[model samples]
Target chain A: MANTFLDRTALNDLLNGACFLGGGGGGPMSGARPLIDLIVKEYDGVTLVPYDSLDPELPCAVVAGIGAPDAATHGPSFSSAPKDAFLKLQAVSGTTLGAVLPGETGAMNSIIAALVAAQLGLPLVDVDSSGRALPTLSLAAYNLATEPTVLTLANQPVTDEQQATAVIETRTAPQADSVVRALLTTQAFEQEGAFSTWLMTAGQLPGASVDGTVTRAIAVGAALREARAAGDDPVEAVNAVLDGQLVRLSCGTLTAFSSHEGGGFDGYTIVLTDDDGHVVTVSAVNENLLAWRSDSDAPLAAAPDTLAWLAEDGTPLSNTDLRGLTAGTRLHLLGIPAAPILRTPLLAARFAKELAGIGFFGQAPRLD
Target chain B: MANTFLDRTALNDLLNGACFLGGGGGGPMSGARPLIDLIVKEYDGVTLVPYDSLDPELPCAVVAGIGAPDAATHGPSFSSAPKDAFLKLQAVSGTTLGAVLPGETGAMNSIIAALVAAQLGLPLVDVDSSGRALPTLSLAAYNLATEPTVLTLANQPVTDEQQATAVIETRTAPQADSVVRALLTTQAFEQEGAFSTWLMTAGQLPGASVDGTVTRAIAVGAALREARAAGDDPVEAVNAVLDGQLVRLSCGTLTAFSSHEGGGFDGYTIVLTDDDGHVVTVSAVNENLLAWRSDSDAPLAAAPDTLAWLAEDGTPLSNTDLRGLTAGTRLHLLGIPAAPILRTPLLAARFAKELAGIGFFGQAPRLD
Candidate 1:
């Protein structure tokens, strides 16, 4: 894929696509929207460069916010956390990062990387550690790497009294994930903070990340926008963009939903009823983990497979957006196959634990 | 005071004295006893040097364990945490510390500093950040310094699965204290870890620490031991060592005791009745905070004044040891004034918040 400039229209579409691909969690579009607007207004647009185009030895790090999406409203805004984390990582590691990579694919997480890259006058790599939003760092592709993961977290304190940052260096991804989650509960963070992780040279990116995710999100978003303008089925347009990989699992109503927020995640269970009276229950921890019909023991899809909800206007709704959804509201559930890199045994083992957490005990099945 | 080598007997005495001075918290004697024994057996013993004797510009730092004393029983042994924290601080700060200082005076906390100093072949400074064990870093004399406090925390994992370290740097003592406390709740720590903080040069130490605290503890311990061997009143011997500063407040029975542990602290309330039927109650969070007679409005003592309990044999009983006593067990309560350096306006402001936390809204009373 060629380099791209994220102008206003393109940035909006990318956010829409990334939110849908966020598979329910990612981050709130409301948070990403204003940040994107500010980025475009100030710097015109961020430059997105393909990962392979950069020098193989150029150091880079993944940047994203790590915490419960719902908790963001309660504390300091994350406007400065990403930049702060980025600089702190550089300071602690004694390496000058050449570019910024998205830690995961989410409206805010992805755009935040772009914002950091733009603000620092560095290129935003057209790739991400996870092709879709994941609840923990363990599920990201970079976790499969053999190198140590050094994570730096920064919280923008609401007042001058709170602690601003911490650096965690560990030999494994799971340990890093565990430590970061624990920090979110601290008085300084309060279940919300930004982080930079997976510091590595450009040569290591191809083996540890999903390439073209940024472009893919933009393409999917463009399709959604074009379909909405032409008054066509946006879901069908999105499926076409994925070469018919999107599985239309069910068209139903939001009959029931309950959410519990803690441990740096917004865990929820959603119950929906199809027009044919089939009931489906979905379980999630930040991102959608599993979906299954009540009448069948087999799951419709599990994590590592994109599980999404589309509104009547074909706009993607994140779990944050789904919270305000009322009973009987029309919603379409779609499942898109995860990036092939995410289906490997290494990544599968990580997702299995998360899926098992919500009652699904089997390996995540491929959607396409 | 002259520099002293910590022989086995001296080390034991130091532990006893530090535990007595720990007020109530400073870490449990049981934990410190074995470690001190091991240190003496392996390295012969630690070396203690007066703080001012070192080159005025030599870099140094304080090292100690930070967490609930009770929680230590459930997690990995902290035998290596102090050393780990010390090395990590040196690595992150890029400064070769010339000596080690005790973060606070406690049986385990004080001894751990000696352990780190011995292991690193560095001198253990006689001065301490707090003359007595304090519940939080905010109460330390070093908190009064204008320089930033860089704190490094390390947990020795039970298995190879946990993240072992974190570095926290902040402009104020409270923020550093808050961040470290938050990290204790993480899986990597679980309320027990070692930390090194207050990184500075020897020139900065005199203004930010209490001098001769180590020797003072040793003297107190020697008095207790000598009195016990002589079949004399150990409390009176201790008072004599302190130049009559120790006040015999009450001799009573442990009628009631309750403890609640969380947030890296073991909070408790104890009640006792003197021989004259006077009822006294003591409140503590790790270390004893306040003691008052139920019949009188004035507190017998409040931290940073030391409230201590002595057994029939004249041995100092830490709050951890007090937990095992049955109702009606005989005990003596003594009050010792805090070091003059701890009574400054700057340190008082920090202690006020902690005192207010347990329902004491007024200023900490001067025990003398």
Candidate 2:
């Protein structure tokens, strides 16, 4: 897919595709859609491509943005740094264009890429740093020995209107992460919690990393929208488009919720103890960081794959989205992680390092 | 003036010089002596020069090391992050050698300068970003007004060395405040925060922008050390070297203390109530962010020059010094800033606009 211009209709399928494709590590679907829509609306001429399809020689850049998913939903307006970060790359280096994607695939990763893509007039690639969603910055395939190569690293954040800041630097792939995560903390000020990076492949295929991802996302989105319109349940539409199964979900409210202040936005479980202790949990760190899988009350690993509370009609809802999620509120369970980030060391490293340092890592880390 | 090789003997004199030269906003002397000694002993090749004489062609850095005065004495360590921050910058940027200095001219500013300079094998630059000390990143001369210049700015912090999580990025000087502050918060969480930065000013007529600051810091330290050996009061020795005097000293114990979680250091205050039921309050964001001087049982206007606290024995102690300060331990106040940080717009701009957000202006902010 060269240029996938996703209209409003294709959002669902694209989200579903990105989710499972997130390989249990991409950002939640809810985060990427609204923000991406806002970006697309802000600039009507943007194009998104799957990471693998961008011309091997055409200039392209990897683009991704992250923030408190709550702020993203509420004050989603980004600080000017990332834009400055991107433009500075051009200022320092003469790279005209290249494929781009979030440094890793997480709940908010795609939208950040979409936002940058729409703004920079470059096609966003569908390939993700991780094959699926991840919890931390270092967990990208790009950073691993498999296909490690990063093209450009930049810092763009707008602390205030005229107080925008940016930096562009060249980096090695493994180190791309240190640059990305550091930039996130720097730009956000506690909010620097999110970061972005751009990369190009080395050797026989020399171009931006994650070449054809955007188009793939749109294709998935379009298929879901079509399925929904055809009267098929949105979950079915998602499964068919993504070759995934729409796990049955029971709607419920966040019996407990906390903003998990300091650094990221973290929330708690949806207990269906009403059904003789039928327990379910819904969690998030910025953009739905995780969800535990339950098989007859048995526990599964978290992060890479997630469960969500939504309207029976297939509308995803979170703590911020549904102020009062009642015990029996209609809910839907959707699993998405286009890139396999949960399986990477990135998640382990962040939880062990930062969150622990801040004393915010609440649960035991998963190593499955 | 040209170079100040602040060996152990020079600590007191430099502190007095910075305090006197600070005109009203320098820092305390308590922690400065030991910190200077700590740096000199550790590295043995430390030198401080005035900011004006630095050759533009020379590579240099600016760091905030040692314990932030208030933070050091508050049972936490600030030297960790500032010192660690710069090393990461060097690693990521692959730059070696240059100059280093206190980010400002407060208690830990110059002292940290020595600590980092010696530790990093760099000279301490006496020319601080601010002629005196100002509390915000914007207070430095190298700011937004000088964008697109070669003054590359980067920051790194370690919340958990285990995970080795930190943030690093280059940005306009304005946004650096937020970035660094966030890194500080991570430090606050970790209980020990210290960081350093090599404010790269290679392309901006580096000589014109920075003076021979490293030598000056060393000179100040040497003079004070000489005085101490001669049995002269460190304060008197410092004053004589810097051309200043000892004003009234307020006596009290810590009433409250909080970590300058923003990576500056942990902050605490000493409440000195004069005989007439009056309170002289001291507050610190990082290294005594501000001081409220007392006048005849009433707070004075911006009356105190730089506040330099000291042990009765004339020993210098900073928040990072970690000795002789407790919830009820006695303290001697060196009057400076004598006004709430919010009182002076000039000073407040550093904390408010640059560190916090600029949206706070327009309420007619002033020193109380």
Candidate 3:
């Protein structure tokens, strides 16, 4: 299990599964696919190693993109930029990194870790800080993970074209998260649409990373792809992959939608009305945070509990894609339990109030 | 002159003169004086050296406070914070700095250079990037300084309760300036107000720094103080120090005033109507940029020209203090020539259009 090598099928499945888990964030695969494809082709294959198998003293870096998910979908035409930030982290930390972990598991991030690992000739850990995509760095699973021996170094390079130029070194994950959040407001980064964030180490992976999430995402993708090919309902295939945890909430048409971009987030509220006159309102900053029934004040779903909305045909859409949704646009809503690590009382309290501030609230999914 | 030591009288004179030359910016001396007095009292004396007398290969830094000049006037008592940016510059540049130059001649910056020099055991160069104050880091003398065997290392320490947390290193001055400007927008700095900037070198001093400006500022201060003590008109005394170069422009009442703060700058436009019905409008973003005469498209004074507005009693006022001025408040305006280096066509063109965008335009004072 520690030496599993992902072939093309596993890679594609990982993308598909992570896209569904993105929950209207993690950016679109349109920008991520080509880069991952090139890496896989050039490198021949990528390694996925369990954190427990790695040397406990070896450091690991968390690799993920930062910014509004939609930025990549716009006209900028992103090429596979050099991994200067990755190399910078290595240089600044003065530590030789043995592996890289996904900062989160989502549309782009799940594969991004693999891509960086392939480029660096290192293994992609079978874990991530966020088992599912969530907005804001503070929500990173590594931030919530009990403190370990590893330190997080956040590096942003001053490339010729981009204006983001910052490097923060800190022992505390909260301080690292806070400083990078502040950097997001700079004139350059505020407009960056998508930037990169690299954090954590292999030693912290056992405690900080959501275990086996990479493999789980790939499994979800494989199930859906296989079911669709077999002439079975792909939506049902996704539900089966989650062990009946994917709860079908509603099927309706979007009646209203509005969003504003600020503080490095695209905040939006979506209203949907079913044919039977039932209404559902979903609020989100990047990922969908909460879903509420028309007559009930309580949340039907909340973060770190995830509410994923998709076309009935099972096309996963990011927040940017949601912008195109109009009145009478049909969609299906489903809820899934968040990663077990995020459900603990201590971790839940960390972002619960912030989640409520954006009109999202409810208990996170607890461990069985 | 290269080894001249600044005594109490010279230090006081520097403040007095810099206030007059600030062009209604550079912050007030209220906050700076105490810091300088403490350093001077503790150290006994601070060294002042002329740039031409120094070794050509040695590097120097331009040190000055950053942010809206008015911020220090508000709360958050500042003690001698560590010169991490200074130490960082030395560290990043990998050079032993020979001296430090004041970024500009201003209320606070005049003394700040000396204070840092005393703390670091370095001499204060008798030169500055700006002969007088202008807004924005790009306008700093070293930023405009043509060339010298020097590299700039801009450091900003994220301090809380006056303790610095981190330092960002870069070779480019604008990038350093940009990063620091962004830092100013952060919560701690936005309220902390006066941050510090150290850039340039002693070698760049000949081309970039205004030579003899330190002595000149002191002379101006001494003349004003002497006249006030002698019961002579202090305003007239200031004119005599400039050898009649200070042209009395108008004696008027403020008829209208408006300002906005953005990018850590207080941008304002002031309208003054003279007793004889002559009207003048002045525009500034931190430092006065232009003075427009009644019905004239041309400017009476422009950057890098100096326009000083003072109370009838000859007290110089920064833009922050002018915020308290009422529609019928009487004041006097005078225009002085800018430094010779700033008058160069190359340097003047750099910011001329930006100055014009803010409604400031005119030819700088030419050397006779």
Candidate 4:
């Protein structure tokens, strides 16, 4: 496949699809939009190349923003943090990364990866570490490797004068996740930072990464725009693009929303009530982790399955976006089956731990 | 000044003096004792060299333990953490450290520096970053340099199998302190870790550090030992060695103690009552930061100056050591004037912040 150059329209579609795929935790699209526009204006556009087209031995780095998405919206915009982390990682590790891989599929994270790629004159890999957004780096399939991983975290300037950055080399993904999360609490970071990790050669990508995720996101996003223009249901359009994996869980009024931020994550529970009096609750630590009807003992959907929301206009709503909606706002809840790779037993076990953190103990149910 | 070889006897004296110098915060002697014994056994003895004897361009690293001193007593003894941090910093920065500089004059911290020096077949510099144990690295005189400082923190195994380490480079000491403290909360660290920082050339030591600290500690320790053997007051012996810098603050019974642990530091307030009903309170966050008479608005002594406790048996009590004593235990509190270098205007400002953290907003009162 040829390399795809992203224009403004294509960038918008990609972000929309990534937001939907983020399952409600990829960071706010509002924060991502201006950044994406900046990237387009400054670098002209980002180049996304099929992973297979790269040399198998060419090294790549995964770039993403870490910490509570809502908190990120208020901080000194870490607009340069991803690039700083990327450059620092290269300098510290002495590894010349030839391409950039998105850490996960999220509006902000994916765009950050693209921005880094554009800034460095490198191509963005068509593959991602995780096909969907995850609350912790440990959940990314590519991060499960037993080999030592070297990660660099860079925060935006704490003041007009000082910047903080760290290089962590860990034996496991969980260790990296814990260290990075703890660092977000520092005065230098203030609950958000950008990180580059999981340096890998393309040869190591086949079994470790989700291929074609970038293309899939763009396709889904394009379908949403096309369906809306043609006056068809955009939700159905995205579902068709996802091979019928989307399931509408409810159409209701948001009745209550509560959230607490701690340990670098924004944990929240949203209660939705339909006109018929049926109620459903969605819980998330960063991304939506589990969702269940008020009367059901078992969860209606659990990660690695995706849970997301859409406004009446069919725009994908990130967790950051959802947090801004007041009670009585009409919304549509949807579940998208996780990519097949994410449903494998090993990945599923990891997802189960994330579910357990928010009080869900059962297995992840099928959403398709 | 000539090099002083630390035999078991000299090592013991150094630790004793360092403990008293640590005020109340340096790690417990119980923990430092074994590690000191191990170093003595393995390396025969550590070499303490006068700062003036080293080549002016010789690179050195400051070695110390970071986080709650008490928590360290229970974990897998970070017996190797200091050496690990030292070696990692050297390797990562490509600087062959010729000497180990003590981060502070404290029982455990000084010993750790000696241990690293011994393990690496390097010399232990007679100077220290801080003349007294401090609650934060920002208060260390050597750390006030405007140049970028690179620090490495290495944690003992989170389990029997995994170790975590991070390398942070920051433009200021406070930024490095904040980052390291934040990292201590990670699963890899669990509120305790060892660090090596303030890598510098021998030429940078003169104005930036407290000279003759190791010798001073040894002298103080030997005085205490000699006085005990001669049936004289050990407190008075230590005071004499300090050239009248030490003053008797109180001879009292422990009345109440309350402590809370957070942000990787153990903060506590201690109340003591004298025979005639005079009461004094000491406050510390990891180290004894301030002392005051209940009847007076002025502080008897504040950090930079030291507030140390001694058992009736003449043993210098670390904060960790003080915690185990029950109410009604007899203790002697002594105030020692800080090293002249530590009394500079810049360091005084730093100490003021530490004093303020414990609700003492006034200036760090002169102890002399």
- TM of each candidate vs. truth: 0.51, 0.41, 0.47, 0.51
Single out the weakest 10-residue window by summed lDDT for candidate 2 chain A: A353-362
* Fnat of candidates, each listed: 0.00, 0.00, 0.00, 0.00
List the pairs of residues colliding in candidate 4. none
Q: Which digits, one per residue and each the tens of the lDDT, describe model 1 over residues A34-119?
A: 77877898899899999888999999988898899888545555667899999999999899999998988888888889889888
Per-model interface RMSD values are 28.0, 22.8, 28.3, 25.7
Where's the lowest-lDDT run of ten residues in candidate 1 chain B? B356-365
- Summed over model 2, clashes come to 163
How far is each candidate from the true structure, as Cα RMSD in Å? 22.8, 22.8, 21.8, 22.0
Model 1 chain A — which ten-residue stretch has the worst lDDT?
Answer: A355-364
State the TM-score of candidate 3 restricted to chain B.
Answer: 0.86
Which lDDT values do the candidates have, in the order given?
0.82, 0.46, 0.68, 0.82
Q: Over the stretch A24-98, how does candidate 2's per-residue lDDT look in tens digits?
A: 234445556666567647875346554446555665444555433444454434434345556655555566655
After superposition, which runs of candidate 4 have C-alpha atoms over 4 Å from their true positions?
A: A1-368, B146-148, B158-160
DockQ score for candidate 4: 0.01
- Candidate 2 residue-wise lDDT at A113: 63
The candidate maximizing lDDT is: 1
lDDT of 4 at B345: 81
Name the lDDT of candidate 3: 0.68
